[model samples]
Every structure is written in structure tokens, then in C-alpha cells.
Target chain A: MTRRASMAASLVGFGVSVAAIFLLPSVLELFTLINATIYVSMAILALSLALIWGYGGILCFGQAAFFGLGGYTYAVAAINFGDSTWAVVLAMVVPALFAALLGYFMFWGRIGDVYLGVITLTMTLIFFKLFNATAGDAYKIGKAALGGFNGIPSTPPLNLPWDVGSPLAPEDIWYIAASLLVLLYFGSRWLLRTSFGRVVVSIRENERRSELLGYDVRRYKLGIFTIGGAMAGISGILFANCVFVSPTMFSLFYSAQVIIWVTVGGIGTLLGPIIGAIALQMIVAKLGTLEVIDPNVVLGSILLLFVLLVPKGLLPLMQSGFDRLRRPKAPVPVEPAIRPTATPAARRPEPVSAPVGSAPATNTLGGS
Target chain B: MDLAVVVLLQVIAAVASLVLISIGLAVIFGMMRVINLAHGEFIMLGAYAVIYATRWGVNLWVAMLVVAPIVVGLIGVVVERTVIRFLYGRMIDTMLATWGLSLLLIGAATMIFGNVTAGVSAPLGGVTIGEYQTSLYELVIVAIVTAVVLALMAVLRFTQAGLIARATMQNPAMAASLGIDTSKVYAVTFGAGAALSGLAGALISPLSGVVPTMGVAYVAKAFITVISGGAAIITGTLSASTLLGSLNTLATFVATPVIGEVTLLFAAIVLLRILPQGITGKFFRRAL
Candidate 1:
């Protein structure tokens, strides 16, 4: 699709998502409504990872570090200030700052991509250990006790932006969550279209080459990493409002699960991961109810099958099937949009795309 | 003096265990560049193999030494043929796939063995160290690890299999041109790595018992040790395991177990920050 066409389609997606926030609650039960809210929040988390891992080339295994930080930050800030507004802002800013600090060490140190995985993985372990160890009265962060293993059961929910007394019901939270998801989806699309996003992708594809080409690779990496961290923090805020914040938020399970969501969804595509997160979460939830099948078994099988057979993920697989049905021509893989109209369409670095906003998320991703 | 002897013995045991758990992972990673996130699962499988073997009236020694490695090694070969071969060059994808495999193995173990169980108990009585007494099994572990290390060295240094494996890892295309079946080498090497992991798991089973999720604990430590080891597989792994394991053990003695674990991770972070290629990546450039 042309850039104009893609932008128009995005506007439509943006519209439908906004419509769903208010429309879905009317049709769904309260429990389902709450679950949908959780899904949206998780989708936001997935999108944050998609941006960094897919485009920025930084495979952060410790995304949950920011996520848990966001939750803890909001919990502590909310309790101390007796207000949700500043807590929300603090949630985003604190994790972003944390990511910036960590990213500075990583990017400046010339850490290899795999070592980035180890460092980030260690970060999550540290967060988990720190948070889990907070079990006593002495472990108080402001008035809100870290509560250690129990987490902060007293975590205040999000009140109205203008009205402090009106804490959002599950239904109301769903509206905000769904609307935010739509906005982020578009925001990610817009970001990928910009020259800044191109540099990030270029860096992902060939960091040394991009660096030699005069773009400061580390700065681009640090930018996307911080942005991704902030987005993850927002998800944490939403998650806190929905459920009590806990140490499990920074767990290895979550750290690895988020990556599985992206990989199973489609690594390079934003929409793929969002759908993957929501869909996989729903599937796992459903599996939880069944007695015979283990959720991990199902999840593991799906991930294995996806990796072995559909390595690019389910979204790309379906999109290609749709393309084949729509046209007899062989699927022309997504092209780099950096050159816009000047380039005839150089083959994308990876061979995967969704017809909608197929921003240069080339799937043949490897540094060497 | 008696107390000091025990403390030193404890540290050696700790370092030896670290080397055992991480060496297989180092071999696979240092040779093939595959992350093998399922390595922990491989270890768990070995422990389970011991559990089932002993339960089925096999000797405890045979279960830990022979059955675990062979069973898990065969499984490793199958995994390579079916899953890993497709993901040879893609490091991130390989991690994801192996992670999935890890989950699969965990779930499978749960179905077969239930959530947790006491595996085969450690053999032998306590041995006195001056006024202090410690589990003789600790000494046994140290001895077996030493044997494993020497055997690994002999294999890598003296065998044609070792040379071909190294050649294939160094330059697969050139190795292929030289009529070396690099694909078979990859499969065998992966099996060997998995077999080593299995042996480590079996060795530790009597101490820690068996659980499906047990691999989760080992995987991170293995990764930390191997990455800290850097490029040279054997020397790198030995040095890293010694440095990290001693720090971990000494820290445990000084503070809480949680602090000890955290210190290991923290030290790895600092180490990687200073030497991104890992310890061997910077020093010991020539010692394989």
C-alpha cells in the first residue's frame, strides 16, 4: 500500500479500536470486560517490546524490569501523594529514566546484541530479587510498604483525571485501556514512518553500517529503548489499576513470556505482537479452565510450532495467505520506506509484512 | 585451621558445581553460538532420568553416570534435527525456540512425574574435615567434575572428532569444502553439550531433588557463567565458574542466599560491562 493509503487505513483502525472500548462492554459480561481490559494493557506491553526488539534491534529480556518498576513506582507514588495523576506520570518517567541509565551503560559499552540479552535478563532478576526481598515494615517506600511477596494489596486504583473520588470501575478502565491501545498502535505506526524510526530500523539491520553512515547508532538505540520503556511503564500503570502490583511483575516468567508473545505473534510487526499478546493471553486463560491440558504445554507447543514452521509468526502467515487469495502475483515482501518514492523499492532486509502499514519490519533479522 | 579447611572445601565444591552446570552450555555456545535456552530443561531431564532409573531398580551410580546423559543426549539430537537446524544462524530466534522447548519439556515432565519429587538420595556417609564434618558426596562431586574436565580436555585435544568439530565451528563453509560433514558435526556437538548438561543435572539431583521447574534456576546461572567465560570454551568456562562460584559461595557465607545469588548476577553485569566479549574474549585469547 502507498503511504497515503496506509495512513488512511491506520485512521480506520484507530477509529474501530476507539469504538470497541465503549461498544464491547455493552455486549460482554463484567468478568469478560475486566479480562479484556487486562488484555489491552498486556497488548500495550507487547507493543513496547515490539518497538525495541523488532525495530530498535535491542532484544531486552528484562522488559518486565520497567514494567514492574512502573507498577511499583505508581503504587508508591499513588499512596504517598494520595493522588493517581502524578503517580501515572511518575510511572512512565521513572522507568524511562531507568531504561536511559541502563541503555547508556549498555550502548556506550559497545555490548553485543546477545550480551544485551544477558544484561537485560540480569536486570529483571535484580528487580525481582529486590522487590521480593521487600517483606518487612522497614521495606516501606514512602507510606506504601513494598509488602514483599504479598505485593501491595492496598495499591490504589486509577481515579478520574479531574475527579479524584471517582475510581474507575473495571468497565471504565477497559475504555481507557482500549483507547490507549489504539492510540499507541497509531503512534507506533507514525513513529515507524518517520525518519527517526527509519534510522532505528537501519540500526537494527546494520548498526555498524548505520553508524558509518553518520547516524549515531547508540543515540537512536537509547531513544527507542527509553520510549519502549515508557510505553511498558504505561502498561504497568494500567495493570496496577486493574490488579494489585506484585514482584511477579518482574519475574523471569513474565520476562520470557513477553518475548514468546512477540515471537509467536511475529517479531518485526507491531500489529502482529499486539494481536499475539491478546490472543495468547486469552488462549492461556481459557486453557487455565481446562483440567486435562496444561497452559504451558499448549503455549510451548504453539511457540515451538511457530518457530519451526511459521518462524515469522501467525500474522505474517495469515497475511500472506490473504495476499495469495487476493492476487495471483507472488507476494512482494515489504520494502524499506526510507527512500519513499525515490527508490523503486529495494528488497526489505527481512521477508515479512502485514499489508496494513508494512513499515520496514524486515523479518530476516540478524546482525551478522 | 580445621574450620578454614572446611570453608575452603565448601568453596571448591561450589566452584566445581558451577563448572559442571555451565560447561555444557559453554561448549554449545562457544562452539555453535546457539544460546540453548532449553539447557536448563536439559538438566532437569537428566535429573528425572536418574529418578526414574533408580525407581526402576537401576543402581544409583549407573543412573547418574550413564542413563541420564544417554537419554538426554538422544533427545538433544532429535531436537537439533527437528528444531535447531532451522534456526542455526538466527541467535534470537534460537533463544526463543529453545525457550519454547524448555517450557515444553517442563510441561511434559509435569505430566509424567507430577510437579515435584525426591529423587535418588546421595550415597556415602559424611567425611570428617578436622573438627568439621561435611557430606562425603561433596568430595565425590569434586572428583567426578575433575574427571569430567580431564576427559573433556583429552577428547578436545587428542581426537580427530575434536579437530573436525573445531574446524566446522571456525569456518563451516570452508569445512564443508574440505569434505567435512558439518551438519553431522553440529548434531554430535549439540548432543555432547546436552549430554554434559544431563550429567550435571544427575550429579546435583541427590542434593537438590527433582522438579520440572528446577531447570529455571540452573539456566540463568549457566548463561551467566558461560558468557562471563567468553570465547575459549574450556579455559573460559573454568575461569568464569571459579570466579563466579567462589564469589557466590563466599557471599552466601557472608550474607543471605538471596544476596549471594544477586551478587553473582550483579558481578556478571559488571563483568560484561567491562568485557563485553566476556573474560576469555579479553584475556586468555590463545588458551582454548
Candidate 2:
């Protein structure tokens, strides 16, 4: 029975993926290919957010910083090295390294959650401001010059090792993206199922408890953060190849939008964010058919509604509802028996007081 | 001599406006623990208010007096109740939610008022201070922000409500135990922060043309100011503002506007690295 259920689930997941790949292009023409490519890039970004938030429980408000870093790094490299695959590798590697260095300093120095959010956010702002200023400068990393505000333009496309002759066409690019997405999805799933993955989840659930269990919490966080950064770097490489790289990629607005994407999709679930990216983009494409509504307004309204109403994300909500419908009806609906009885108030769990700086906020307040 | 003085006035005016908004943000953050990402949207609303009022033929200063704070404060309260209430304690969620909210507001504003930078006329063309003929309107912004800051300091020091706010910020449970309504203080403080941002927007609209995207610039600077001033979580947001304003004026007078901005951000980050607690901790230690 369990084997049947697992097989059914995998088949359903595969059906959904295949439908998305084939139908996405039919509804929107070749634009879907471009859209999928962008979503793939966004998925890489979502992975970064998921790793930081879902596993480490560090709410980074500026994953775009790393995304932008990877993008600019790739763009600069591409411009300099012409379209060398090796250059593309370096482009992605540089950002991952940079994120690792950033994580190292931040994690080791013991910047608590709030301050860590701020530090990363500040880096985002600083990068944009710096890059925005550098736009006019004749600064060249390799052969490519930093265009500053105008951004690097007309950069050569990626040169894959096995093109099988001609450059990777639009349809081919879509296939590449779909395949990469599949690999990442499965890889992330496998990673989370590992012992280290279990440790990461436990850290998210209770950092202090994990530390008391003698796990080096910061090292684990840094490792996962670097992985997230690498995923973002890979996404950036794909993004640079898809379209012209620009400074706007590094902007806070993009960073903020990426966070919204992860939230809209559901953070912890591996496949959820990809669903979110594709769903939101498709909705915007459909809205594009209606000439009246501005795309920004449509996107903004939907995102606002989703973030406010469906914070657990659309995918998770749908999955649970689907599971409910599929399941056999119980003779009596479980209520009190489902939840364990509340522990005695007198023997209440001690308030896990964080170091004044690291204290998990009980009250919701917006900052970074 | 004239160019130098005009540039100086421009610098002072810009810095002063930034300070007022940042200080307002700092105080709100100090009291309520909200970063208020939509603070810039409040500024945008204020600018629109002044613009609409000006079209209605109201005296600029009088219109600002009647409109900015009230409009901004009302929006603040509505937001506090509708959105911000859900965000308390979940800082990351709040940040992302407010960011989404800001995008919604900006998109709505863009749809209503096309994508264009609209200019508002300064009430007084120029007011002469000694040998310097400065824009009297710009100086007025500086004066208003200064007066407001002073009033806030006095309130925080003496008023019972202010004391309660300070107490709640320092120790929420203790304040609650003493029957102080900390939640009310948080809501009110958030509203007040929104109002300051609006006021700053209205005042600066004359010097800096109002645009939907203008909020982006202010958000970054305000964050920098908050960090630099180290104002009791959020109180000193103004101090960084004032300092940055002065530094901005000095930089622009000596070099280019871009250099001034770059320098300010660079200095702020450096300051952040050196003094984690910011200027507040530097000036006065909060007793543990």
C-alpha cells in the first residue's frame, strides 16, 4: 500500500513537471521558454532563501545580493573572457566564494538573527550603491567593462562544452533549465534526508537545543549558506545567458521580490518554490493578455494577497487539501486526540532566552 | 561666493530633510521594534498631499500644516492595524510583508500618477540670512525638523507616555507587569514614524521633485542614518540624518553630489563595523 502511494505521488509530481514544460510554451509561445528560464534562475534564488530560512532559520531579506553578485560576476567574466565555459564557471564560483567569505565573517563573529539580517541587507544596499556608482567608470575586470548604471550590454552567451554543434537554441535552453531544475529539486530532497540535513532541520527547530547537543551550529549554518549561495550563483549564470545582465538585477527591489517568491511558494518544501515561481510568472503572463492592467500592479496585488493570506504558500496548502480529498473518511473526525494535551502550566517549558542580541523576536516588527 | 552659498544651502536642506525622517524612523523603531519599510511610502503620500493641496490654491506652508501629518498619520494607523499587527515578533516576515506592501503602494501610486517626476513650487523664492540668500523654504524645512526633534526629545525625557514608551522598549514584560499598555505605545509610535516620513516628503518635494521611485533613495539613507546615529534602536535615526546632512553639504560643496552619497554610505558602513551599537551607545550607556 505504501509503495503504491509513493509511486502515485512520484507519477503525479512527474505529470505536473511534464505538463508545466510542454503547456507553458503552448499558452505563451516561445515567451514561456524565456519565462521558464527566469523562473529557473528564481528557483536557484529560492533555494538560497530556503536553505537560510528553512534549514538554518536565518531570515535573510537580501538573497538578491548574492544573486546580483553572481550575475555581475558572471557578466564581468563573460565580457572579459568572451563566452568561455571556464569563465562562466568562475563567474558562478566567485559569488559562491564571496558568500562563503561573508558567511564566515558573519557566522563566526556571532551576528545574531536580527543583526545578521541587517548585515546582509546592508551588503545588498552597499553593492547596489557601489555598482550604481561604478556604472560610469571605465573599470574592466577582464575584457568586459562595468557599465555602472547602464550595466554591461551585448555580452556573449554561454559556451557549453557539448553544444553538439550549434549554439544552445531557445527550446534547448528550456530543456537545460528543466533538467537543471529537476536535478536541483532531487538533490535538495536528498540533501535534506541526510543526517546533516536532519541536523539542519533540528537547528531551525531549536538552535540552542542543537548547540547543547554539541553540534557546531554556526559551522552548519555557514555550510548550508554557502550551498545556498552556490545555487544562486548557478542561477545567475543561467540568468546572464538568458538575457542581458544589468545593474537592476542587484537592486533591493529584485531582492525583495525573490523573498516574496519564496514566501508565496512555501519556504521549507523543496518543490514548492519552483511551483511558486512558475505560477506567479504564468499569472503575470495571463494578465499581460489584458492590456489594461499594468503588470507591476497585477504582480504586486497578487503577491500582497498571497503573502498576507497564504503565508504557508500555495503549494503546501494545495498538497494537504489534495491529500485530504484522497484519504478515506474517518468514522469520527479526530480533534482532541490529534493534538497532545498541553503540558501543565506549572511545569511550563522554560522560556528559551536567547543572548540579548540573538533573542528570537516574539513580536512581529518589519526592519530588514 | 554666491555659488558656494547656494550649494551650501542645498546641502543643508537635503541633509535636514533626511535627518527628520531618519530620526522619526529611529524613535519608532526604538519604541515599537518595527523597521517600517513602508516609511518611504508615507513620504510619497505626503508629497502627493502637498502637490494636490497646492493645486487647490492653499498656501504651501498652511497646506503642509493641514495635510501632511494628518494624511500620513491616518495611513500609518490603518497600516498598523491592518498589516503591521500581524508582523510583530516575526521580523523577517514583517520585512518581506512590508516590502510587498510598499510595492503595492508604489504600483498604485504609479498607476494613479503616471511615471513622471512632478515639481512643487517653493513658497518663498529665497530668504536672505546675513550675506547669504538661501531658499527660505528650504531653511524652513530645517527649522521645522529641528523644532520637531527638540519637542520629541523633551517628550521622551519628561512626559509619562514617553516614559512608558521608553520603559516598554527597555523591558516589555516589566512595563506590562506595571500595567503599562506597551502594545498601544507600539501602534502610536509606528503611526508617529509614518507621520514624520510624510512630513519630510512634503517639505522636500519642493527641493527634490516628487517621483514614485524617490522612496528607494530615502530608504537606503534612512537605514544608514539609523545605524550611524545609534539612536536607541530608532531614536538616533535623526542624529545620523543630521550628521549625514552636514557631511552631504560639505561633500557636495567640495566635490560632486555622487561623491557625497558614496562617501556617506561608505562612512556609515565603516561606522557600522566599528561601533556595533552606534552613536547612542557611544554617547550614553543604557544601564543594564
Question: Against the true structure, whose DockQ is highest?
Answer: 1
Backbone clashes in each candidate structure, one number apiece?
A: 2, 20
Q: What does candidate 1's lDDT look like per residue over A1-368, in tens digits?
A: 44465557667876777677778999999988888888899999999998898777688999999999999999999999888999999999999999999999999998867898999999898889878988999998778899888899988988888578888788878888998988887788778768888788778766778899999888999999999999999999999888889999998998888888887777677888899999999999988897687788888988888877876676666766655575567554453222211001111224343454433432222110
lDDT of 2 by residue, A133-196 (tens): 7754466666677787877777566656634244566666776777777677767766766777
lDDT of 1 by residue, B1-288 (tens): 988888899999999999999988988998898999999999999998898899899999999999999998999899999999888877766888899999988888888788867677679999887778999998999999999998988888789988888888889999999999999999999999999999999999999968999999899889989998998999999999889888888898899878888888999999999999999988999877
lDDT of 1: 0.85
Kindly report which residue stretches of model 2 are placed more than 4 angstroms away from their true locations once superposed: A1-8, A11-28, A135-137, A162-165, A288-291, A328-368, B1-15, B123-137, B167-183, B227-235, B242-256, B270-283
Specify the poorest-scoring 10-residue window by lDDT in model 1 chain A: A339-348
Alpha-carbon lDDT of model 2: 0.69
Q: State the displacement of the C-alpha of residue B119, model 2, in Å, after optimal TM-score superposition.
A: 1.6
Q: By lDDT, who's the top model here?
A: 1
TM-score for each prediction? Answer: 0.93, 0.85
lDDT at A13 for candidate 1? 73
Model 2: TM-score for chain B: 0.89
Check candidate 1 and list the clashing pairs.
Answer: A350-A363, A350-A364
Model 2 per-residue lDDT at A38: 80
